[model samples]
Target: MFNKKYTIVKNEEVIPGHRLMCLNAPEIASRAAPGQFLHLRCGDGQDPILRRPLSIHFADRGRVYILYRIAGRGTSRLALMARGDIVDVMGPLGRGFTLPAPGERVAVVGGGIGAAPLFFLLKKIGKIYGKKKDMVRVFLGASTLAMVPGAAQIRKMGFPLDIAADDGSGDFKGTVVDMFRKEAKNLALDRVYACGPPPMIRALAGAVGPDPAVEVSVEERMGCGVGACLSCACKVRAGEGEGFGYARVCTDGPVFDLRKLVL
Candidate 1:
């Protein structure tokens, strides 16, 4: 991990309340992998002392992008930042998703803002697979059409995109998981990756049921963004015992096997 001040190359609103910010940070960007995230300081002063962790939306040669929604003071302040503004950040922290092997059929499922990290995963998969033969499927879900960000860009990539809006504002009128269930039999999926709210993850875990191929990126409130704080702890089923054990999301995961997670 690296701690550096990155210049905001681009900062714009992607949707109604969401913003996508690109930062110039070659070191971090180069090392970043899909499902990893960055911890941003929002401001220089101590106003918002703790850094906010955001998933790495996409990373290129010398830049990293973060997609976030303005939900609180830290994000609201971050939204005010203009192009060329600098922000303190530390990352490409946490374990990321494992890419599927060649000829392996995989499915990526994301919900709402949770879709952010999956973009990087899709890009990496595209580069590795290098075919337009429907080897990968992308599923996105949101409460409404307005809440689904990056739909056009994802669609343009030609990955057999499936979308769902709870209010029937999108192509599929149900939860993203619902869409997945409806299409599961036809896809012949070998592996599955997902990220979203707790409820959605829980439902998905149950649906998949002990399938070790299912990997999920979890969302949790973090403090230090490192192992020291123990601020982002998640429970998982114990190996020998019946109870659960704690794992730090910042270090041990943020990405975990759906069957092992206590969801």
Candidate 2:
């Protein structure tokens, strides 16, 4: 969890309104895990006072990748940065997804930009589980065909992948949760990891019922990346007791058990 200014090695648009920024930060990269994020200071200005939090898209060698959507002032500032520019970042923060034991049937779900981290997760699994990679399947969704995440890479890796697009532009023309529900009826998945819109997350929770096999990487805004501030609080089941308790997403998790989440 280092906080420092890192040099931007590359910044390219993967699609309109979305940019992929790479930083030369070996320290953070080496420690990065799937589902972890970085707090990036968008610019030198004081407007938008808080730094924007972006998920770690990919990390390799000495480079860390950030895939972000340019939706507002913070992200807009990030978009203006070019290769060789310096960016302030605090990273590898929060708990990441847990890996499955060998021979376990695994499924990963990602929606829209949330798929960023899942790509890194899948890449690692594909590498570590090579011959047994066949046990893993992936579901990805986006608003359009152009927005779908990691389809090409997933396909090339020979993993079974199902893509759903809201605009009916992919192999499946429906919500990703719906696609998973339809197909998951037959296969008994040992562990499922997901990250996406709240509605999608909630729907997935409902679809899976009481199964604790589902783990979700939540998307929330942060005040202090290290969890000192009380921002990014999430609701989760408080066990046999009466009510729900608040969990700090920045520290307790960004990833949580679906059965334990309050939705």
Candidate 3:
């Protein structure tokens, strides 16, 4: 919930469609948890209108990293930002993933750009549950191997990784959901955390059906990263209501219990 102005120390392209930006924001990093995001304002003035929300990829002692894809004009402008640039940032916002407890077997599933949050999640999970390290498993999926961070690095962190791609280009040539199903079929899991495109998340929901431990990250276009504008409403499974209801993806959650959400 912190509103901190950060100066960009480094902004570099890490992959073909994505850029990694490091910011000097000690406060946000200090309080940030895995799966959280930041709302970044492009310019000093309001010309761009709304702030773009970027996933918090990694954070260290006095800095935070955001990984984003150049999907539109706003993100394109953000990619062009130079080093030493100052941007208005609000967050470490939204609810983050629940850290695993002792001996809790956890599974992390991510797809496409969704791998952003899972990076931090992996680090945090390892930090908290390292004593029971053997209980955790991570699966990442993308169109190709280049889209995800190196698997060796993630495995070095002590979590076993299962990778999949769409075109038979990698280990499992199918959707990330396929990886989830394959892993779930082979292992005993206590909880599952997922982030990806809508179709991926929806498919994951089906794959994780009736599992109370499955949590998902919701991605949607937003006019306001904050909930005040109600511009990022998404259809969600209404608990007691007749059918689906609109929920604010920004505030209510970017992370939700998979069984509770209609997706």
* Residue lDDT tens for model 2, 1-263: 99999999999998878999999999999999988999999988889779998889899999999989898989998999999999999988889888777778888888888888898888788887887777898999898888975688888887888889988988799999888888777677888989998999988987864443888998777899787997899998896766799898988899898877888
Q: What does candidate 3's lDDT look like per residue over 41-157, in tens digits?
A: 887766777789888999999899998989987888899898998988999877878777777778899888888988898898888885667788788898887888646778888
The lDDT-based order of candidates, best leading, equals: 1, 2, 3
Worst 10 residues of 3 by lDDT: 203-212
Alpha-carbon runs more than 4 Å astray in model 3 = 240-242
- Residue range with the least summed lDDT across 10 consecutive positions in model 1: 203-212
Q: Write out the backbone clash pairs for model 3.
A: none
- The sequence of per-residue lDDT tens digits that candidate 1 reaches over residues 1-263 is 99999999988999989999999999999999999999999898898888999999999999999999999999999999999999999999999999888888888999999999999998888888887538888889999987887888777777888889999988899899988888887767789999999999987876654433998998888998888988799998987667899999998888998878886
User: All candidates' TM-scores?
Assistant: 0.96, 0.97, 0.94
Which residue runs does candidate 2 get wrong by more than 4 Å? none
Q: Would you list the C-alpha lDDT of every candidate in the order shown? A: 0.89, 0.87, 0.83
